[model samples]
Target: MYRIMIADDEPMIRKGLQKLIQQSGQPIASLRLAENGIDALNQIRESCPDFLFTDIRMPKMDGLELCRHTAELDPDIQIVVVSGYNDFEYAQRCLSYGVKEYLLKPISKKTVEAALEKLVYLHSKHTSPAFVSVHRLEEWVGEAEAAIWSLNHETLVKVVQQARVEISSHRLRLHQLIDLLDEFTVLLFKRLHSRDIFLFTERAPLHAADDEDSAWSQFQARLVLFFDELRMKRRGKLKDPVEEAKLYIEAHLAEEVSLEDVAERIGLNASYFSQLFKQSTRETFVQYRTRRRMEKAKKLLAQPHYRITDISGEVGYADHPHFTKTFKKYAGCLPSEYRNKLGIDR
Candidate 1:
């Protein structure tokens, strides 16, 4: 029978992990919950658990301090650090305190199961020598970090897949894979931090996997989904504002349409929207509106029923000579000349 403790500020996370450990069918002798690192430390002193799952950021003594204290109190207890974001520097600090496994936020059944399995393995090997030395662990972690920093998603996925396969093949322990993945995630996020991408910010809870292969497969699927959804979201962001601005300009061709008015309609700052509009459409607002009005005047001129003055008014111009000069500049011909080219005369 193994005693386990979950330390987190979130009631839901603590209760949820407790339920998952009980349902995993692991020989869990007892389960305990703590709202923060201080409470967790008190609980440990009162009754030292064989294993602990803790969140890095917590009130009244963060997970890092708790890990350090736990190490001094009970060096034999295995700990898995739980967190949401990937802070590589912070992870290195935690690793110094003997934390080998990391569980990402919104943890699911599969992750919980894997974590517990790793804890069980640690429990079994507590009195025995470690198969992989500390030096080897650092080497693998370095390799994982390099793959993530290279920014080649395919190569990174392949590297992670290879590691996953080793775990599935039983050549590597589950805890070791979790450590690599945790490092990879931290490096990946640090690389992508300045890109304004929100892939890791919010995530739904993933379901538990029954085995290593299933866990790895789920990880791959989530990556693909992240790229697909991120692409679609960014495309929409670039396309939507310009398209809406164009529609508004087209609808009010005879009225004043300033950048501020169009930006207001789109719920964006005028200067920012102006930049985005030009970036997306490759034309300044003045140039685009002038071209649109000239095009409309040309079409109306083709009808032969509308006079030059009416056509000018239709295209938002009240002065005939000014409109004529503008038409000649845009269309390379006077309005009458354009009508003649179209074989029409009033």
Candidate 2:
């Protein structure tokens, strides 16, 4: 499915084009209209549509400049220019920017169809690539660590969706796919451990499922839950030096938050602060923090909008697997199960 946008100064022209495109029964997944180049540009930035149609003359920004800006922002987007002028210079200028079709003012269904045929062919040629390679998948997992940790739901969902697509396309054996998921989960754990965050939970043993679909579904669900608790180990409150340390931890949950770092921030000896935190909270600083994180995680899990990965980082665990494990230990159920018990649709 391809998304398309049309930008024109004339309201009638824009509505006509939209109607024509819909009536043509083309493979257009969606069609949007913008009154002028500025609105069109904003839409392009937000949706990054695969196709665009614009008039040569418009208020605020002309079609030529829109073409230039679109080329810079998304060179892959196919563009068709509609103009009243048949000037050769306009044609040459549009050609220089890789505009797909140059239609005259009196546009017809036949001409639009001809332009769409070319655009569809180009779109096909551009999008027939296979799944992402394993190397690239690893790179994305590493790059997504921060978003996964910070509870950035938008970025996290995008990355997870990409990974899901790649995994589905690979068609690996059930065991092989499980191994891949395990490897990725381990990478997340390694990232968290590097920051001295410790995590423990009952490892849900993987069985030989009948098919890859079951395993993949289970794995992704677990990962979603794991991500939900990533930052649980960093949220909490305390007294005096411990209170200051807790505040510091809350403010820096997305960073490499460490006991030493917080202790230093509060002008307390790290060793003494550790003992003091345990005495004050009846749990070690880490345990206290994890408990607080679990509390926050429970609240976030109740909301359908929060991704588990984002919640994991929000509470401060970067390694999603570890976050999941520790969350289960604290909450006595997997995050997803917790969400279900709360009668929420995840």
Candidate 3:
């Protein structure tokens, strides 16, 4: 079990962090907490952890000082900053000190899950001497050892990166790799919403390849084609609770929402709604909602009157970095890329 240490000045914050770390999939062998930096330092000398999560500011010894001193105690210990947006600049300073993740306060469960997921992913990816097998690659991609469905950005990055690494390493012969990857991405996508009707499509001609790279490249090209088709096919279209839920989302674009809230609005159970929504849309409700919001966000940003942060919050992202990641995923570029293109590149 991976050990975790959580530190914060506030009792409630520490309590919440403890709960989140427990739920984050990194099982607690021993969890030590401190009210401030000095207490944390004293504890670290006795018991070192694989990871340390600390708030930036506190009464006697703030998180920054704790993070710095903790590293001097154990440079190998991974650190993630848990603080407010105002503390981010200070958090950045901790990076030179060796912090792994910069977490913001008003912490979401998703954010915590993402952080632990990375540590878990890193631990497994680097330590296991096991050869990358077709089945094992898929298995690693799906590890829930903690709940990851609601997580975003970094968690998603870890998942996608693991998938990319296991698949892209030229681990198999070119033709075989393509066939394996072609099947893998397809199954992963379809499995999420397997209960719904799937519009089947033709697969790429793997047998056509006389060489490895050509075959793999052809397969990747086809995969891209298939996703583009899938996206276009699903975009702005509605079925099941999908249409009603999306209408609700679009209508309440600026307000706070939860899975339960959306379910209640449509008089459907959250589990059933989540599954069916993913089934029909080939994306989770959160993903679909974010995609739509980003679509609107891009349009709004293209206009002269909108402020980026205000638009970010309006679209349901409390953090601009979160919004930026969501924007880049759907648009295949950054917001500033779009902005700069309009101002001068055009």
Candidate 1 regions off by >4 Å? Answer: 128-346
The TM-score, computed over Cα atoms with residue i paired to residue i, of candidate 1 is 0.37
Q: How far is each candidate from the true structure, as Cα RMSD in Å?
A: 21.9, 18.2, 20.2
Q: Per-residue alpha-carbon lDDT of model 1 for 1-346, expressed as tens digits?
A: 7778899998888888888888898877778899999999988876678788999999999999999999987777899999997888778988899886877888889988898888788777763432445564455445544554444567657766665554444443333334344454444444444455443322222334434465566555544433433443555544466778999899887776798999888776676666556645668898899899998897898787798898888888878799999999998989899989888876
Local error of candidate 1 at residue 329 (angstroms)? 98
Judging by TM-score, tell me the better candidate of 1 and 2: 2
RMSD of 1: 21.9
lDDT per residue as tens, model 2, 1-346: 6688999999999998888777766877779999989999988765567789999999999999999999987777899999999999999999889898999978888888888889989977775553346688677668567776676768867776787777677545344466666777667656755755544122243444546677666655555544544533344322355566777766665566678878777665676567556645567777766677788888889999998888888887889999899989988999988988988867
Which candidate, 1 or 3, has the higher lDDT? 1
Ranking by TM-score: 2, 1, 3
Please provide the root mean square deviation of candidate 2 (C-alpha atoms, Å). Answer: 18.2
- Stretches of candidate 3 exceeding 4 Å from the true structure: 124-346
After best superposition, candidate 3 residue 328: deviation in angstroms? 71
Q: Tell me the TM-score of each prediction against the true structure.
A: 0.37, 0.44, 0.36
